[model samples]
Target: MARESFKIFYAGRNDVILYEGVEEVLESLKQKYVLGVITNGNADTKKIGIDHYFDFNISASDINAGKPEPIIFEEALRQSGFRAEEICHVGDHPVNDVEGSSDFGMKSIWFNEKELDWPLDQKPNFKEVNSWSELERTVESF
Candidate 1:
């Protein structure tokens, strides 16, 4: 899992902090980047106020082909005028996030919030991150 790759800080904590600075961040990257999200989750990211974070969103409800299929990710790329190699995907699930993204030549970051152990068949081209703060740092540094 996560601890195997990224450094884990804490054991378990679920403190949610919605980004109030989302608008600023989006505005900063809006023109230079093509922002979109492809997720297998059921929630509508737009309705949840994350719409500003991404220019487009492809959810399980929107795509019949779910994670591991590459359809959702492909759809997002197609809509965003991006090539797979230039795209970056972040997800906690190894198969869904890493494998799916990697299969399509997109770089992935394993968002391993839960510190666990897992052996991969191939070296995933990613950096595993443990917490949202770590994730934020990674994103900001990008």
Candidate 2:
């Protein structure tokens, strides 16, 4: 048998640097909201060095489901002890984050870093944030 070289993608190998002002904004929001993370990616917050900021992290692995589904959001809502209306989920994906949250009866802030137009079909009018600063402002307003 011939040996074949393979590339295995390890989650921790990639850089995990926080965006500028992320820590400060997290620190401020931590004082007000019960911070939680619901991500499709397999990021180790401890390895990323931002685990301290989040009260809880609900990954796909944790719930056997990912975004665009109410299960994960419901789990976070349960953990948060807040009404669905009081919670705001911020995500980059239009359908998964914006539309999904709306469907689940939670507010959403869509992070559109490129300032792209809403895709015609999934044109959700959720609050759009172009930068972390904008996200912080939007979250603070809630």
lDDT against the true structure, per candidate, is 0.70, 0.83
* Candidate 2 per-residue C-alpha lDDT over 1-142 given as tens digits, one digit per residue, 9 for 90 to 100: 1222212243443356778988988888898878999988776787778889999999888889999888989998888888889899999888888998988888889888999888857565578899988877897676
Residue pairs with colliding backbones in model 2 are none
Provide the lowest-lDDT 10-residue window in model 1.
Answer: 7-16
Candidate 1 stretches with Cα past 4 Å from truth are: 1-32, 136-142
TM-score of each: 0.71, 0.88
